[model samples]
Target chain A: MGLIAREIEAAGLPTVSMTSAWDITEAVAPPRAVYFHAPLGHQTGPAGEPDTQRDLVARALEAGVSIEQPGEIRALDLRFPDATGWEATAYTPEAIPMSPDGKPNRGAPREPRA
Target chain B: MARPADAVPYIERTRALYARQAPYRWVVHDLEHEPPPWTPIRSSLASSRVALISSGGVHREDQEPFHFRNDVSHREIPADTPASRLRVSHFGYDIRDAARDPGCVLPLRALRELVDRRVLGAIAGPALSFMGGIYSARLVRDDLAPRLRDLVLRQQADLAYLVPA
Candidate 1:
Protein backbone atom coordinates (compact mmCIF):
# COMPACT_ATOMS: atom_id res chain seq x y z
CA MET A 1 0.00 0.00 0.00
CA GLY A 2 2.77 2.43 0.95
CA LEU A 3 4.96 1.76 -2.05
CA ILE A 4 2.03 1.87 -4.41
CA ALA A 5 0.84 5.19 -3.07
CA ARG A 6 4.32 6.66 -3.40
CA GLU A 7 4.55 5.53 -6.97
CA ILE A 8 1.22 7.07 -7.81
CA GLU A 9 2.15 10.34 -6.21
CA ALA A 10 5.44 10.30 -8.01
CA ALA A 11 3.54 10.10 -11.26
CA GLY A 12 2.21 13.56 -10.40
CA LEU A 13 -1.18 12.79 -8.93
CA PRO A 14 -1.75 13.41 -5.25
CA THR A 15 -2.79 10.26 -3.36
CA VAL A 16 -3.73 9.17 0.12
CA SER A 17 -3.93 5.65 1.55
CA MET A 18 -6.06 4.52 4.47
CA THR A 19 -4.08 2.03 6.51
CA SER A 20 -4.40 -0.33 9.44
CA ALA A 21 -0.61 -0.74 9.53
CA TRP A 22 1.03 2.45 10.68
CA ASP A 23 4.33 0.69 11.22
CA ILE A 24 4.61 -0.31 7.60
CA THR A 25 3.40 3.04 6.31
CA GLU A 26 5.95 4.87 8.40
CA ALA A 27 8.68 2.87 6.73
CA VAL A 28 7.53 3.12 3.13
CA ALA A 29 6.58 6.78 3.50
CA PRO A 30 3.89 7.35 0.96
CA PRO A 31 2.89 10.90 -0.03
CA ARG A 32 0.07 10.80 2.53
CA ALA A 33 -1.70 8.14 4.52
CA VAL A 34 -4.45 8.09 7.12
CA TYR A 35 -3.64 5.71 9.95
CA PHE A 36 -6.59 3.85 11.35
CA HIS A 37 -6.29 2.00 14.63
CA ALA A 38 -9.25 -0.03 13.52
CA PRO A 39 -9.06 -3.60 12.27
CA LEU A 40 -7.69 -4.40 8.82
CA GLY A 41 -10.93 -4.46 6.87
CA HIS A 42 -12.48 -1.61 8.77
CA GLN A 43 -10.10 1.20 7.78
CA THR A 44 -12.85 3.78 7.34
CA GLY A 45 -14.90 2.58 10.32
CA PRO A 46 -17.21 -0.26 11.27
CA ALA A 47 -19.52 -1.90 8.82
CA GLY A 48 -23.14 -0.66 8.77
CA GLU A 49 -21.94 2.70 10.14
CA PRO A 50 -22.22 5.12 7.25
CA ASP A 51 -21.66 8.34 9.15
CA THR A 52 -18.40 7.21 10.65
CA GLN A 53 -17.25 5.87 7.32
CA ARG A 54 -18.09 9.14 5.62
CA ASP A 55 -16.35 11.17 8.27
CA LEU A 56 -13.12 9.23 8.12
CA VAL A 57 -12.98 9.10 4.34
CA ALA A 58 -13.72 12.79 4.09
CA ARG A 59 -11.03 13.59 6.61
CA ALA A 60 -8.45 11.61 4.69
CA LEU A 61 -9.37 13.45 1.52
CA GLU A 62 -9.18 16.76 3.30
CA ALA A 63 -5.74 15.80 4.53
CA GLY A 64 -4.68 14.80 1.04
CA VAL A 65 -5.34 18.31 -0.20
CA SER A 66 -4.59 20.47 2.81
CA ILE A 67 -1.51 18.73 4.16
CA GLU A 68 1.49 20.71 2.91
CA GLN A 69 4.26 18.16 2.89
CA PRO A 70 4.84 14.71 1.55
CA GLY A 71 5.10 11.48 3.56
CA GLU A 72 2.58 12.66 6.10
CA ILE A 73 0.06 10.48 7.91
CA ARG A 74 -2.57 11.53 10.40
CA ALA A 75 -4.09 9.03 12.78
CA LEU A 76 -7.82 8.56 12.39
CA ASP A 77 -9.10 10.36 15.46
CA LEU A 78 -11.95 8.10 16.42
CA ARG A 79 -12.51 5.01 18.52
CA PHE A 80 -13.93 1.90 16.97
CA PRO A 81 -15.65 -1.03 18.63
CA ASP A 82 -13.67 -4.06 17.36
CA ALA A 83 -10.03 -3.11 16.88
CA THR A 84 -8.42 -5.98 18.81
CA GLY A 85 -7.86 -9.80 18.87
CA TRP A 86 -4.58 -10.21 16.96
CA GLU A 87 -2.88 -9.81 20.32
CA ALA A 88 -3.93 -13.31 21.25
CA THR A 89 -3.07 -15.24 18.08
CA ALA A 90 -0.43 -13.10 16.35
CA TYR A 91 2.59 -14.33 18.28
CA THR A 92 1.84 -16.06 21.51
CA PRO A 93 5.27 -16.49 23.12
CA GLU A 94 4.19 -19.73 24.72
CA ALA A 95 2.64 -21.01 21.53
CA ILE A 96 5.77 -20.26 19.49
CA PRO A 97 7.91 -23.21 18.56
CA MET A 98 11.11 -23.72 20.53
CA SER A 99 14.40 -23.17 18.78
CA PRO A 100 17.48 -25.44 19.01
CA ASP A 101 18.83 -23.05 21.67
CA GLY A 102 15.67 -23.70 23.72
CA LYS A 103 14.59 -20.10 23.27
CA PRO A 104 11.20 -19.39 21.79
CA ASN A 105 11.31 -19.54 18.00
CA ARG A 106 9.81 -16.35 16.67
CA GLY A 107 9.92 -14.38 13.51
CA ALA A 108 10.68 -10.71 13.72
CA PRO A 109 7.70 -8.45 14.27
CA ARG A 110 7.75 -4.77 13.20
CA GLU A 111 11.14 -3.16 13.27
CA PRO A 112 11.76 -0.62 15.98
CA ARG A 113 9.74 2.48 15.10
CA ALA A 114 11.68 5.35 13.65
CA MET B 1 4.41 16.52 11.94
CA ALA B 2 4.10 13.27 13.91
CA ARG B 3 7.11 11.83 15.67
CA PRO B 4 7.99 8.23 15.04
CA ALA B 5 7.73 7.64 18.78
CA ASP B 6 3.98 8.10 18.62
CA ALA B 7 3.66 5.32 16.05
CA VAL B 8 5.19 2.51 18.12
CA PRO B 9 2.05 0.74 19.27
CA TYR B 10 0.16 0.89 16.01
CA ILE B 11 3.23 -0.40 14.25
CA GLU B 12 3.41 -3.36 16.59
CA ARG B 13 -0.29 -3.94 16.16
CA THR B 14 0.23 -3.97 12.39
CA ARG B 15 3.06 -6.49 12.55
CA ALA B 16 1.07 -8.66 14.92
CA LEU B 17 -1.87 -8.78 12.58
CA TYR B 18 0.33 -9.55 9.58
CA ALA B 19 2.17 -12.26 11.46
CA ARG B 20 -1.11 -13.88 12.36
CA GLN B 21 -2.26 -14.27 8.77
CA ALA B 22 0.71 -14.56 6.41
CA PRO B 23 2.69 -17.75 5.86
CA TYR B 24 6.10 -16.30 5.17
CA ARG B 25 7.29 -14.24 8.10
CA TRP B 26 9.53 -11.22 8.31
CA VAL B 27 9.81 -7.98 10.22
CA VAL B 28 7.59 -5.09 9.21
CA HIS B 29 8.93 -2.91 6.43
CA ASP B 30 11.68 -0.65 7.69
CA LEU B 31 13.34 1.53 5.10
CA GLU B 32 14.46 5.08 4.57
CA HIS B 33 12.79 6.99 1.76
CA GLU B 34 12.85 10.37 0.11
CA PRO B 35 9.83 12.57 0.66
CA PRO B 36 6.88 11.43 -1.36
CA PRO B 37 6.18 13.38 -4.53
CA TRP B 38 3.54 16.09 -4.44
CA THR B 39 0.80 17.51 -6.69
CA PRO B 40 -1.43 20.24 -5.42
CA ILE B 41 -5.06 20.21 -6.35
CA ARG B 42 -5.56 22.83 -9.06
CA SER B 43 -9.20 23.45 -8.27
CA SER B 44 -11.32 23.58 -5.18
CA LEU B 45 -12.78 20.35 -3.84
CA ALA B 46 -16.29 21.33 -4.86
CA SER B 47 -15.43 21.38 -8.54
CA SER B 48 -12.61 18.84 -8.73
CA ARG B 49 -12.98 15.53 -10.50
CA VAL B 50 -12.45 13.00 -7.77
CA ALA B 51 -11.54 9.33 -8.05
CA LEU B 52 -11.75 6.55 -5.49
CA ILE B 53 -9.60 3.47 -5.06
CA SER B 54 -9.21 0.65 -2.54
CA SER B 55 -6.85 -2.19 -1.78
CA GLY B 56 -9.67 -4.33 -0.50
CA GLY B 57 -9.86 -6.46 -3.68
CA VAL B 58 -13.33 -5.25 -4.59
CA HIS B 59 -14.76 -6.07 -8.02
CA ARG B 60 -18.03 -6.14 -9.87
CA GLU B 61 -20.18 -9.24 -9.38
CA ASP B 62 -19.41 -10.52 -12.86
CA GLN B 63 -15.67 -9.89 -12.75
CA GLU B 64 -13.16 -12.59 -11.90
CA PRO B 65 -11.57 -12.56 -8.46
CA PHE B 66 -7.97 -11.59 -7.96
CA HIS B 67 -5.77 -14.54 -8.80
CA PHE B 68 -3.49 -16.30 -6.26
CA ARG B 69 -3.17 -15.69 -2.54
CA ASN B 70 -0.65 -12.93 -3.14
CA ASP B 71 -1.82 -11.12 -6.23
CA VAL B 72 -0.71 -7.99 -8.03
CA SER B 73 -3.68 -7.95 -10.35
CA HIS B 74 -6.39 -5.30 -10.05
CA ARG B 75 -10.00 -4.78 -11.07
CA GLU B 76 -12.06 -1.82 -12.27
CA ILE B 77 -15.22 -0.81 -10.46
CA PRO B 78 -17.72 1.69 -11.80
CA ALA B 79 -18.24 4.82 -9.76
CA ASP B 80 -21.99 4.43 -9.45
CA THR B 81 -21.99 0.71 -8.68
CA PRO B 82 -23.87 -0.19 -5.53
CA ALA B 83 -21.97 -1.64 -2.61
CA SER B 84 -23.98 -4.87 -2.72
CA ARG B 85 -22.70 -5.52 -6.24
CA LEU B 86 -19.09 -5.74 -5.17
CA ARG B 87 -17.10 -8.46 -3.39
CA VAL B 88 -13.82 -8.76 -1.48
CA SER B 89 -11.07 -11.34 -2.16
CA HIS B 90 -7.89 -10.09 -0.56
CA PHE B 91 -5.65 -12.50 1.34
CA GLY B 92 -4.14 -10.15 3.88
CA TYR B 93 -7.13 -8.94 5.89
CA ASP B 94 -10.33 -10.26 7.33
CA ILE B 95 -12.91 -9.83 4.57
CA ARG B 96 -15.94 -10.06 6.85
CA ASP B 97 -16.16 -6.35 7.58
CA ALA B 98 -15.66 -5.34 3.97
CA ALA B 99 -18.09 -7.95 2.72
CA ARG B 100 -20.83 -6.69 4.99
CA ASP B 101 -20.18 -3.07 4.04
CA PRO B 102 -17.47 -2.34 1.52
CA GLY B 103 -17.93 1.34 2.23
CA CYS B 104 -15.87 0.56 5.30
CA VAL B 105 -12.88 0.05 3.03
CA LEU B 106 -13.84 1.34 -0.44
CA PRO B 107 -16.15 4.19 0.52
CA LEU B 108 -17.81 4.54 -2.88
CA ARG B 109 -21.03 5.48 -1.20
CA ALA B 110 -19.36 8.29 0.67
CA LEU B 111 -17.69 9.54 -2.50
CA ARG B 112 -21.02 9.64 -4.25
CA GLU B 113 -22.70 11.37 -1.37
CA LEU B 114 -20.07 14.05 -1.44
CA VAL B 115 -20.68 14.53 -5.11
CA ASP B 116 -24.38 14.80 -4.51
CA ARG B 117 -23.87 17.46 -1.88
CA ARG B 118 -21.61 19.39 -4.28
CA VAL B 119 -18.63 18.77 -2.06
CA LEU B 120 -17.11 17.26 -5.19
CA GLY B 121 -17.55 18.20 -8.83
CA ALA B 122 -18.02 14.68 -10.17
CA ILE B 123 -16.69 11.15 -10.06
CA ALA B 124 -13.92 10.82 -12.57
CA GLY B 125 -14.74 7.32 -13.77
CA PRO B 126 -14.36 3.73 -12.64
CA ALA B 127 -12.19 3.24 -9.58
CA LEU B 128 -9.28 0.85 -9.45
CA SER B 129 -9.48 -1.99 -6.93
CA PHE B 130 -6.69 -4.38 -5.98
CA MET B 131 -5.78 -7.17 -3.58
CA GLY B 132 -2.56 -5.17 -2.69
CA GLY B 133 -0.64 -7.71 -0.54
CA ILE B 134 2.15 -8.04 -3.09
CA TYR B 135 5.34 -7.89 -1.07
CA SER B 136 7.58 -7.17 -4.02
CA ALA B 137 8.04 -3.54 -4.88
CA ARG B 138 9.19 -4.53 -8.33
CA LEU B 139 5.89 -6.22 -9.10
CA VAL B 140 3.75 -3.36 -7.93
CA ARG B 141 5.91 -0.89 -9.80
CA ASP B 142 6.04 -2.91 -12.98
CA ASP B 143 2.48 -4.17 -13.05
CA LEU B 144 -0.19 -2.61 -10.88
CA ALA B 145 0.79 1.02 -10.40
CA PRO B 146 1.15 1.79 -14.08
CA ARG B 147 -2.29 0.46 -14.82
CA LEU B 148 -3.80 2.53 -12.07
CA ARG B 149 -1.92 5.58 -13.23
CA ASP B 150 -3.32 5.11 -16.67
CA LEU B 151 -6.85 4.83 -15.32
CA VAL B 152 -6.49 7.93 -13.19
CA LEU B 153 -5.23 9.84 -16.21
CA ARG B 154 -8.01 8.51 -18.38
CA GLN B 155 -10.51 9.77 -15.88
CA GLN B 156 -8.75 13.12 -15.54
CA ALA B 157 -9.18 12.97 -11.82
CA ASP B 158 -8.01 15.98 -9.86
CA LEU B 159 -7.60 13.96 -6.69
CA ALA B 160 -7.77 10.39 -5.54
CA TYR B 161 -9.03 8.85 -2.29
CA LEU B 162 -7.51 5.44 -1.73
CA VAL B 163 -8.25 3.04 1.11
CA PRO B 164 -5.43 0.58 1.37
CA ALA B 165 -5.38 -2.61 3.39
Candidate 2:
Protein backbone atom coordinates (compact mmCIF):
# COMPACT_ATOMS: atom_id res chain seq x y z
CA MET A 1 0.00 0.00 0.00
CA GLY A 2 2.81 2.39 0.82
CA LEU A 3 4.39 1.57 -2.51
CA ILE A 4 1.13 2.48 -4.24
CA ALA A 5 1.01 5.72 -2.25
CA ARG A 6 4.48 6.66 -3.44
CA GLU A 7 3.56 6.01 -7.07
CA ILE A 8 0.35 8.02 -6.80
CA GLU A 9 2.14 10.86 -5.04
CA ALA A 10 4.81 10.86 -7.71
CA ALA A 11 2.06 11.24 -10.29
CA GLY A 12 0.94 14.48 -8.57
CA LEU A 13 -1.82 13.12 -6.38
CA PRO A 14 -1.56 13.58 -2.64
CA THR A 15 -1.96 10.42 -0.57
CA VAL A 16 -2.44 9.63 3.10
CA SER A 17 -1.93 6.02 4.17
CA MET A 18 -3.51 4.55 7.29
CA THR A 19 -1.38 1.69 8.54
CA SER A 20 -1.32 -0.70 11.50
CA ALA A 21 2.18 -2.04 10.83
CA TRP A 22 4.67 0.47 12.15
CA ASP A 23 7.76 -1.38 10.94
CA ILE A 24 6.50 -1.80 7.39
CA THR A 25 5.43 1.84 7.25
CA GLU A 26 8.86 2.91 8.42
CA ALA A 27 10.52 0.74 5.82
CA VAL A 28 8.32 1.70 2.87
CA ALA A 29 8.02 5.39 3.81
CA PRO A 30 4.95 6.64 2.02
CA PRO A 31 4.63 10.41 1.52
CA ARG A 32 2.18 10.81 4.40
CA ALA A 33 0.58 8.31 6.74
CA VAL A 34 -1.56 8.14 9.87
CA TYR A 35 -0.59 5.28 12.16
CA PHE A 36 -3.07 3.38 14.33
CA HIS A 37 -2.18 0.76 16.93
CA ALA A 38 -5.29 -1.20 16.02
CA PRO A 39 -5.03 -4.84 14.96
CA LEU A 40 -4.04 -5.67 11.38
CA GLY A 41 -7.44 -6.54 9.92
CA HIS A 42 -9.14 -3.82 11.98
CA GLN A 43 -7.19 -0.79 10.88
CA THR A 44 -10.27 1.43 10.78
CA GLY A 45 -11.25 0.22 14.29
CA PRO A 46 -13.42 -2.62 15.53
CA ALA A 47 -16.33 -4.08 13.64
CA GLY A 48 -19.87 -2.84 14.51
CA GLU A 49 -18.44 0.48 15.69
CA PRO A 50 -19.56 3.06 13.16
CA ASP A 51 -18.73 6.04 15.32
CA THR A 52 -15.12 4.97 15.79
CA GLN A 53 -14.74 4.18 12.11
CA ARG A 54 -16.11 7.57 11.10
CA ASP A 55 -13.80 9.33 13.52
CA LEU A 56 -10.81 7.47 12.10
CA VAL A 57 -11.73 8.32 8.52
CA ALA A 58 -12.04 11.98 9.46
CA ARG A 59 -8.74 11.91 11.30
CA ALA A 60 -6.91 10.34 8.33
CA LEU A 61 -8.18 13.04 5.96
CA GLU A 62 -7.20 15.71 8.49
CA ALA A 63 -3.73 14.23 8.55
CA GLY A 64 -3.63 14.31 4.73
CA VAL A 65 -3.78 18.07 4.80
CA SER A 66 -2.04 18.82 8.09
CA ILE A 67 1.05 16.66 7.60
CA GLU A 68 3.84 18.93 6.36
CA GLN A 69 6.84 16.70 5.94
CA PRO A 70 7.23 14.08 3.26
CA GLY A 71 7.31 10.54 4.60
CA GLU A 72 5.89 11.77 7.88
CA ILE A 73 3.79 9.32 9.86
CA ARG A 74 1.58 10.88 12.51
CA ALA A 75 0.65 8.26 15.08
CA LEU A 76 -2.93 8.73 16.21
CA ASP A 77 -3.65 8.43 19.93
CA LEU A 78 -6.78 6.40 19.30
CA ARG A 79 -6.65 2.85 20.68
CA PHE A 80 -8.81 -0.11 19.74
CA PRO A 81 -11.26 -0.95 22.52
CA ASP A 82 -10.34 -3.90 24.77
CA ALA A 83 -7.54 -4.85 22.39
CA THR A 84 -4.96 -6.24 24.77
CA GLY A 85 -2.14 -8.57 23.65
CA TRP A 86 -3.23 -8.31 19.99
CA GLU A 87 0.31 -7.57 18.89
CA ALA A 88 1.56 -10.77 20.43
CA THR A 89 -0.97 -12.89 18.54
CA ALA A 90 -0.81 -11.05 15.22
CA TYR A 91 1.28 -12.58 12.38
CA THR A 92 2.77 -15.22 14.66
CA PRO A 93 3.16 -18.79 13.40
CA GLU A 94 3.15 -20.20 16.92
CA ALA A 95 -0.52 -19.25 17.26
CA ILE A 96 -1.36 -21.87 14.64
CA PRO A 97 -1.49 -25.46 15.80
CA MET A 98 0.98 -27.94 14.41
CA SER A 99 -0.12 -31.14 12.69
CA PRO A 100 1.37 -34.57 13.53
CA ASP A 101 3.64 -34.32 10.47
CA GLY A 102 5.00 -31.01 11.87
CA LYS A 103 3.15 -28.79 9.39
CA PRO A 104 1.40 -25.70 10.71
CA ASN A 105 -2.33 -26.28 10.54
CA ARG A 106 -3.88 -22.96 9.56
CA GLY A 107 -7.48 -23.81 10.45
CA ALA A 108 -9.10 -21.47 7.99
CA PRO A 109 -9.24 -22.55 4.37
CA ARG A 110 -7.18 -20.35 2.09
CA GLU A 111 -7.67 -19.64 -1.56
CA PRO A 112 -5.87 -22.15 -3.73
CA ARG A 113 -2.79 -20.89 -5.50
CA ALA A 114 -3.53 -19.76 -9.02
CA MET B 1 6.29 9.28 17.26
CA ALA B 2 6.10 7.55 20.61
CA ARG B 3 5.11 3.90 20.40
CA PRO B 4 3.58 2.05 23.33
CA ALA B 5 5.99 0.39 25.73
CA ASP B 6 4.73 -3.04 24.71
CA ALA B 7 4.78 -2.45 20.96
CA VAL B 8 5.66 -5.69 19.21
CA PRO B 9 8.80 -5.88 17.12
CA TYR B 10 6.88 -7.03 14.08
CA ILE B 11 9.79 -6.96 11.64
CA GLU B 12 11.87 -9.34 13.65
CA ARG B 13 8.93 -11.55 14.57
CA THR B 14 7.69 -11.77 11.00
CA ARG B 15 11.15 -12.58 9.69
CA ALA B 16 11.45 -15.40 12.16
CA LEU B 17 7.92 -16.63 11.60
CA TYR B 18 8.40 -16.84 7.85
CA ALA B 19 11.55 -18.83 8.37
CA ARG B 20 9.61 -21.40 10.37
CA GLN B 21 6.35 -21.40 8.39
CA ALA B 22 7.18 -20.76 4.74
CA PRO B 23 9.70 -22.15 2.27
CA TYR B 24 11.15 -18.69 1.57
CA ARG B 25 12.34 -15.79 3.71
CA TRP B 26 10.07 -12.76 4.16
CA VAL B 27 11.65 -9.37 3.73
CA VAL B 28 10.24 -5.84 3.72
CA HIS B 29 11.82 -3.24 1.52
CA ASP B 30 13.89 -0.76 3.49
CA LEU B 31 14.10 2.46 1.50
CA GLU B 32 17.41 4.19 1.95
CA HIS B 33 16.44 7.51 0.40
CA GLU B 34 16.18 10.58 2.59
CA PRO B 35 12.84 11.85 1.26
CA PRO B 36 9.94 10.04 -0.35
CA PRO B 37 7.74 11.33 -3.18
CA TRP B 38 5.60 14.30 -2.23
CA THR B 39 2.54 16.00 -3.64
CA PRO B 40 0.85 18.82 -1.78
CA ILE B 41 -2.88 18.74 -1.06
CA ARG B 42 -4.37 21.36 -3.34
CA SER B 43 -7.87 21.37 -1.89
CA SER B 44 -9.54 21.05 1.46
CA LEU B 45 -11.41 17.89 2.36
CA ALA B 46 -14.68 19.77 1.95
CA SER B 47 -13.89 20.31 -1.74
CA SER B 48 -11.39 17.64 -2.73
CA ARG B 49 -12.44 14.49 -4.48
CA VAL B 50 -11.08 11.70 -2.29
CA ALA B 51 -10.40 8.14 -3.36
CA LEU B 52 -10.21 5.13 -1.08
CA ILE B 53 -7.57 2.42 -1.44
CA SER B 54 -7.19 -0.62 0.75
CA SER B 55 -4.74 -3.50 0.88
CA GLY B 56 -7.29 -5.54 2.78
CA GLY B 57 -8.36 -7.78 -0.12
CA VAL B 58 -11.73 -6.00 -0.33
CA HIS B 59 -13.82 -6.50 -3.44
CA ARG B 60 -17.44 -6.39 -4.42
CA GLU B 61 -19.30 -9.69 -4.37
CA ASP B 62 -19.41 -9.56 -8.14
CA GLN B 63 -15.67 -9.03 -8.54
CA GLU B 64 -13.01 -11.68 -8.59
CA PRO B 65 -11.15 -12.41 -5.39
CA PHE B 66 -7.44 -11.72 -5.18
CA HIS B 67 -5.02 -14.62 -5.35
CA PHE B 68 -3.82 -15.89 -1.98
CA ARG B 69 -0.12 -15.52 -2.71
CA ASN B 70 2.03 -13.12 -4.72
CA ASP B 71 -0.98 -11.57 -6.46
CA VAL B 72 -0.34 -7.91 -7.11
CA SER B 73 -3.49 -7.29 -9.12
CA HIS B 74 -6.20 -4.96 -7.76
CA ARG B 75 -9.97 -4.65 -7.78
CA GLU B 76 -12.02 -1.54 -8.38
CA ILE B 77 -14.80 -1.33 -5.81
CA PRO B 78 -17.53 1.22 -6.43
CA ALA B 79 -17.67 3.92 -3.79
CA ASP B 80 -21.33 3.26 -2.99
CA THR B 81 -20.78 -0.49 -2.37
CA PRO B 82 -22.76 -1.57 0.67
CA ALA B 83 -21.18 -3.28 3.64
CA SER B 84 -22.99 -6.54 2.95
CA ARG B 85 -21.81 -6.66 -0.66
CA LEU B 86 -18.13 -6.46 0.22
CA ARG B 87 -15.87 -9.45 0.81
CA VAL B 88 -12.30 -10.08 1.94
CA SER B 89 -9.77 -12.67 0.65
CA HIS B 90 -6.34 -12.27 2.15
CA PHE B 91 -4.07 -14.64 4.04
CA GLY B 92 -1.81 -12.27 5.95
CA TYR B 93 -4.32 -11.43 8.69
CA ASP B 94 -7.47 -12.71 10.33
CA ILE B 95 -10.54 -11.90 8.23
CA ARG B 96 -13.33 -12.77 10.66
CA ASP B 97 -13.87 -9.21 11.90
CA ALA B 98 -13.65 -7.85 8.37
CA ALA B 99 -16.14 -10.42 7.11
CA ARG B 100 -18.70 -9.33 9.70
CA ASP B 101 -18.13 -5.63 8.96
CA PRO B 102 -16.26 -4.65 5.83
CA GLY B 103 -16.11 -1.07 7.08
CA CYS B 104 -13.45 -2.17 9.54
CA VAL B 105 -11.17 -2.62 6.56
CA LEU B 106 -12.68 -0.86 3.53
CA PRO B 107 -14.74 1.85 5.31
CA LEU B 108 -16.85 2.70 2.25
CA ARG B 109 -19.82 3.35 4.53
CA ALA B 110 -17.84 5.63 6.80
CA LEU B 111 -16.43 7.49 3.80
CA ARG B 112 -19.91 7.98 2.37
CA GLU B 113 -21.12 9.31 5.70
CA LEU B 114 -18.28 11.78 5.69
CA VAL B 115 -19.31 12.94 2.23
CA ASP B 116 -22.93 13.24 3.33
CA ARG B 117 -21.94 15.36 6.33
CA ARG B 118 -19.81 17.55 4.05
CA VAL B 119 -16.63 16.45 5.78
CA LEU B 120 -15.55 15.42 2.29
CA GLY B 121 -16.55 16.89 -1.03
CA ALA B 122 -17.09 13.70 -2.95
CA ILE B 123 -15.87 10.12 -3.28
CA ALA B 124 -14.04 9.20 -6.42
CA GLY B 125 -16.11 6.29 -7.62
CA PRO B 126 -14.46 2.88 -8.07
CA ALA B 127 -12.08 2.79 -5.10
CA LEU B 128 -9.04 0.56 -5.51
CA SER B 129 -8.12 -2.50 -3.45
CA PHE B 130 -5.36 -5.14 -3.55
CA MET B 131 -3.88 -7.85 -1.36
CA GLY B 132 -0.90 -6.81 0.74
CA GLY B 133 2.09 -8.80 2.11
CA ILE B 134 3.35 -9.61 -1.35
CA TYR B 135 6.83 -11.09 -1.44
CA SER B 136 8.19 -9.01 -4.28
CA ALA B 137 8.60 -5.28 -3.87
CA ARG B 138 9.42 -5.09 -7.57
CA LEU B 139 5.99 -6.31 -8.57
CA VAL B 140 4.35 -3.77 -6.29
CA ARG B 141 6.47 -0.91 -7.58
CA ASP B 142 6.60 -1.88 -11.22
CA ASP B 143 3.16 -3.38 -11.77
CA LEU B 144 0.53 -2.73 -9.08
CA ALA B 145 1.54 0.80 -8.20
CA PRO B 146 1.59 2.06 -11.77
CA ARG B 147 -1.77 0.50 -12.58
CA LEU B 148 -3.38 1.91 -9.44
CA ARG B 149 -1.83 5.30 -10.08
CA ASP B 150 -3.35 5.36 -13.54
CA LEU B 151 -6.76 4.46 -12.19
CA VAL B 152 -6.69 7.14 -9.49
CA LEU B 153 -5.49 9.66 -12.04
CA ARG B 154 -8.42 8.75 -14.25
CA GLN B 155 -10.76 9.43 -11.33
CA GLN B 156 -9.25 12.90 -11.07
CA ALA B 157 -9.04 12.44 -7.33
CA ASP B 158 -7.54 15.34 -5.43
CA LEU B 159 -6.27 13.00 -2.79
CA ALA B 160 -6.30 9.36 -1.74
CA TYR B 161 -6.73 7.54 1.58
CA LEU B 162 -4.92 4.20 1.76
CA VAL B 163 -5.78 1.57 4.37
CA PRO B 164 -3.49 -1.44 4.77
CA ALA B 165 -5.15 -4.23 6.74
lDDT score of residue B56 within candidate 2? 88
Question: Which whole-number lDDT from 0 to 100 does residue A3 have in model 2?
Answer: 78
TM-score of each: 0.80, 0.89
Name the regions of candidate 2 deviating beyond 4 angstroms. Answer: A94-104, A109-114, B20-32
Q: Write the per-residue lDDT of candidate 2 for residues B1-165, one digit (tens) a residue.
A: 555565567677667666644543333444454467888788889998988889988887888887656789889888877887888887677777787788988988988999999999999878789988777777887888899999999998888889888
Score candidate 1 by lDDT: 0.68
Model 1, A1-114: lDDT tens digits are: 766676667777777677666666777777777776665677778899888877777776776677666777777666667535543443233322322222334551211111
Q: Which candidate comes out best when scored by lDDT?
A: 2
- For each candidate, the DockQ is 0.31, 0.52
Interface RMSD, in order shown: 7.3, 3.7
Report the Cα lDDT for residue A99, model 1.
Answer: 22
